[model samples]
Target: MKKTLLSLLAVVTCAYSAPALASGGTEAPPHVHWEFSGPFGTYDRAALQRGLKIYREVCSSCHAVKHLAFRNLTDLGYNEEQVKAIAAEYTVTDGPDEDGEMFERPARPSDRFPSPYPNENAAKAANGVAPPDLSLIVKARHHGANHVFGILTGYEEAPEDHPLADGQHWNKYMPGHVIAMAKPLSNGQVTYEDGTIETVEQYAQDVAQFLAWASEPDLEARKRFGISALIFLAVFAGVMYRLKKAVWKDVH
Candidate 1:
């Protein structure tokens, strides 16, 4: 009787834990205010630059911003020479000699950011799952900048009732409360030349803003255009209303 009761209790425990793990039950990411949050908002150039530094020194090992070009760094306040210097730091495969074999050379301003792995298979082999390209990540996620920030800083110890498998980590904001990628940021992980705070929260905020700019470099311009169009339409409507009154007054 005792053995049968122990087996039943074990089965009950597994059954109870299975649903919680499978359901994900992730908490909503905390809200974070951003310079680029509203229609009149614009990207903070200094923050974007700092975020780029973080990406280069840390995130680049596993993630790629394949849609971004070295030349595009100019939008974040880097000059042409600085952009060239940054591009030359990386090597890219290019060209076919007379033998028609691919050759490797320093990256050019025109080249898109290269992937750390040669191909998807290699990336998956190295990491279990391929890290998504970060170029459009801010726009792609539901909460945009806040979501990125949450993931970067959300690492925490698992609850006593919840145990993680090998290679899995607990993230407060991750769906299912588990993530494959370890916490990517730590306090003072990247130095900032501009004297910005070097805490993990600061890094997460700066990188989140940088990803926002990457996802929408023209956000300010688009907002300007939209505002201009709205103003034009409002004025046009007023003028048309006056004309209608002038024209119909005589008829009445």
Candidate 2:
């Protein structure tokens, strides 16, 4: 009877834990699986710059990463002076000028990243849906990199029984399946300084990595932490081994 009761308790525990794992119940397409690993690889500075250019020119039209300020560019491979110069290239609003009218001036590091629209209603009016904020998207979503890359590259025309009508697409399992965003990448779309062909697949992968980098700017710090942890474990093991040898010497 005790063994049967223990088995029942184990089953109940599993049932309770299942909900926690499935918290982000949002469904994705069939070509992907929910995972936590980010874009675990290195990126070339030139490719990253090109990807940023693509983002600023194309994707920025619909999405925004409000947490990122213009000054944040310094964190990415660039030097501080270069970051300031880049910021100066953009105009931002300041208080009234001598004429008592709001005026624009070169962007400052302290300024927040600008949004495509002034507010939610304006954004919805233009796109028919609210563009999701991308501040922590890479960290929040499952299979983040693969999901981002897959969605960017997996866009296709509608299929029979698709949730969206004819000419509208529905991936096998996406929420509405009919994502409003259209495919933005094309072969040789924006020629890269590195001479890498700008294919849709490459664009997707590079942009996904760039987004992952943005989400966790302290990635190098995490790498340092791992190295420290490994050293500590090795020293701990050595001390334990020496103590065991000393203690068992009398037994032998």
Candidate 3:
């Protein structure tokens, strides 16, 4: 335990002390910093929608969201009809015949979304890398939002002058940060219907938020319950105090 703690401390110290630069500059780039700011505070409907769009268009090519059901879209503020329409967009496998052949059908509220690749090996073969399953990625990954933002925006080619780390490749911030994946987003990658330019950084932020929220769909309900519990307790206490005083006055 002592050795592990010391090693962690040393790594953290190095990471902090090393001259870290954000993508496109010598300075660290702006990222969406996450914190516990109530349930509603963390949610931005627009960001979630945009993130969904990015996931559908870009990251879905590699990652699978196996844990999420099509019905869960309602939690993200989509109405049932909207959720149904969205679910219908994806094809899910169905039916068990005597020959046991698989068939593709439109996604339903009950069906889980199908992955782009059949498995990790297939994903690697197709994309030159294994696309990660994003079921609970926001919850599972370390320093999630920061990591996501950093990885998405941080893709600089290593300079010949800089020394490379053993496993590292040419990355924007670190030397030899050879990320297997190519930069998915650049400026003007997605031409939004509203004319908003889809920059890589923006997509990163939105998708991170979406994944974070998807991992915790009960966030809004949890917040609401917490608030209600506090209010109920306060009101009950007030009523109890008044009742005790009234009963004691008659006795006195």
Runs of candidate 2 exceeding 4 Å displacement: 1-44, 96-102, 163-173, 247-252
Using TM-score as the measure, name the better of candidate 2 and candidate 3.
Answer: 2
- Write the residue-wise lDDT of candidate 1 on 1-252 in tens digits: 999999999999999877557657666688998998788888899999999999999999999999999999999999999999999999999979789999999999999988999888898888888888999999988678998999988999999898888888999987777788988888877889888999999999998999999999999899999999999999999999999999999899
Model 3 alpha-carbon drift over 4 Å, by segment = 1-36, 39-42, 127-129, 161-169, 172-178, 236-252
Off by over 4 Å in 1: 1-23
Model 1 deviation from native, Cα RMSD in Å: 10.0
Model 3, CA-based lDDT: 0.74
Clashing residue pair totals per candidate (backbone < 3 A) = 1, 1, 9
Better model by TM-score, 1 or 2? 1
Best by TM-score: 1
Q: Which window of ten consecutive residues has the lowest lDDT sum in model 1?
A: 19-28
Q: Per-residue lDDT of 3-76 in model 2, one digit per residue for the tens? A: 99999999999998674455434355334322223344344555556657767767788888788886777666
TM-score of each: 0.88, 0.76, 0.73
Query: Could you tell me how far off, in angstroms, the CA of residue 80 lies in candidate 1 after the best superposition?
Result: 1.2
The per-model lDDT (C-alpha) reads 0.90, 0.69, 0.74
Q: What's model 1's TM-score?
A: 0.88
